[model samples]
Target: MAEIKKIGVFTSGGDAPGMNACIRAVVRTAIYMGKEVVGIQQGYQGMIDKKFVPMDARSVRNIIQMGGTVLKTARCMDFRTPEGRAFAYKNLKEEGIDALVPIGGDGTFTGAEFLSREFDIPVVCVPGTIDNDLYGSDYTLGYDTATNTVIDAIDKIRDTAASHDRLFFVEVMGRDSGCIALHAGIAGGAEAILLPEKETAIDELIEKLEQSAEKKTSSIVIIAEGDKNGGAYNVAKRVKEKFNFYDIKVTILGHLQRGGSPSSFDRVLGGRLGYAAVKSLLAGENRKMVGLRNNKVELTDLHEAIHNHTFKLEEDLLEMANILSI
Candidate 1:
């Protein structure tokens, strides 16, 4: 293992709620270990473009509770190519960054792995996405905050829904993974949750809404954007054909779920993951993801973490979402 001198860290892809906390932890933890830290802005693209910022203990102060990433984040397709990656590697070498901590979703990890293997740079990925779709980690960095944001919106929607006898189709973000939708749906007490992981027939959904409508004055159906049936607007349109709602409303929620002050759970989880990532790098661990499982930090091989990973919503929770809807 090369004597680690300085580490480079960045948050890529979509910005998440607790990313600032993680960045704060990484900066402070690395500095405490007598290592220098460099913050890369806008992720891999920043590396390629040499957008590096020197960081210290004071740099991360008062940022643990902030929403979004102080480090900023951007999707970089250029980093996927050999020419672009070579440029990124050259930039890292010039900055004397021996190891790296790239925080974000699986796509972020994929880019991190490529850069590490191609240039022999040490890396540890931190799951910082709100989707909570990663395989090894029990929870991703911003999932808790995102779910809370959704539930809060739903609660507000519920007030109006109750007053007007509205049928609300609330859409939450979850591209290819319904983890956020599933959790928030259950927590928000939706009439039904349409997840990408399961097939929810329109007829079945209408039947459920009809039943709920008969008993309650209003109804809520949570839909994951990745749902096979389509998004909230389409689902609401189809449902209106069969079910007559007093007032049908659609709430996209949009990027609001991606922005918020980190919840206590997310803030703490980000700290743990960031601290573990830096510690892992110090232990000569490379090309792995630092995740909390069963409340402890564990490492998973980057290859396995990226490739052979399958995300399934908790079956019991799925069952309860229906059972409790009644």
Candidate 2:
């Protein structure tokens, strides 16, 4: 590959906390390496529409604490087509963007892989989704902040639930992954948790709630969005049938879990991954995802990061969560 003189950076897929921090790191790191950085306003869509901005150290000042991406993000369906990708490439070449750094989740990496292979553009990805579903990185950028946000909501809900002796079914975001739900459920002292990875029949959930109700316990059941037994509303209705306490309530955290000031862990992780991504791109690495494993920066093949998912929480942690909840 030709020498990487200028690097283009963008954030894609869902907006995540600590994204701005990552953007800042990418800009500063690239600038420090004497490479000019171009900020793509909205991922591949921005590339196609020519939404580009020159970034320097001053441009990213004081954005590390921000909740969402300063570069913004979006799902560009058009980027899936060859014509759209060719257009994006034309725009990139026109803008003098020689290498690329994209921060995002699985879909983001898949797009990166496609573009890199098609055009031979050097690309490095930083895992920046709240889902934490990607295989290579143990922790994505926003997982900590989102987990903290859910626990904060759960703690507040606990106070009201205890007062009213209410059974609260709190739904958190984790489509196709239970990382958030499992972490928050264990931390928030939830009585039961429904995860997408584990299939729990409604009857079995009712049996657990029944046991709680018999003890006059004010319970909180954490439900992941992709739970096998539908969502929080459905789980609440089914549990209300047989396990009636003083009251029953369902609270869907929804997107609330996605927006918040980036936690210290997220900010640091974002900076690390972003810095490593630029370094990787400069090292002539292409179609690679930058991640932190065992507290050190590691690079994984973008194709494997997108296609091979072995993300699993400790089974013993789930077991201990159930035991401790009781």
- The per-prediction CA RMSD against the true structure, in angstroms, equals 0.9, 0.9
Q: How high is the CA lDDT of each candidate model?
A: 0.91, 0.91
Residue-level lDDT of model 1, residues 1-326, one tens digit each, is 88999999999999998899899999999999999999999999899889999999998899988998888888888898999999999989999999999999888999989888888999999998888888898999999999999999999999999999899999999978899889898889998999988999999998888788779998888999999997999999998888776589998999999887999999999889999999999999999998888998899998888886576888999999999998
- Compute the lDDT of residue 205 as modeled in candidate 2: 81
- Model 1: per-residue Cα lDDT at residue 178: 90
lDDT of 2 at 50: 99
In model 1, where do residues sit more than 4 Å from their true spots? none
Model 2 backbone overlap count: 0
Give the Å error, residue 304, model 2: 0.3
TM-scores for all predictions:
0.98, 0.98
Model 2 TM-score, all chains together: 0.98
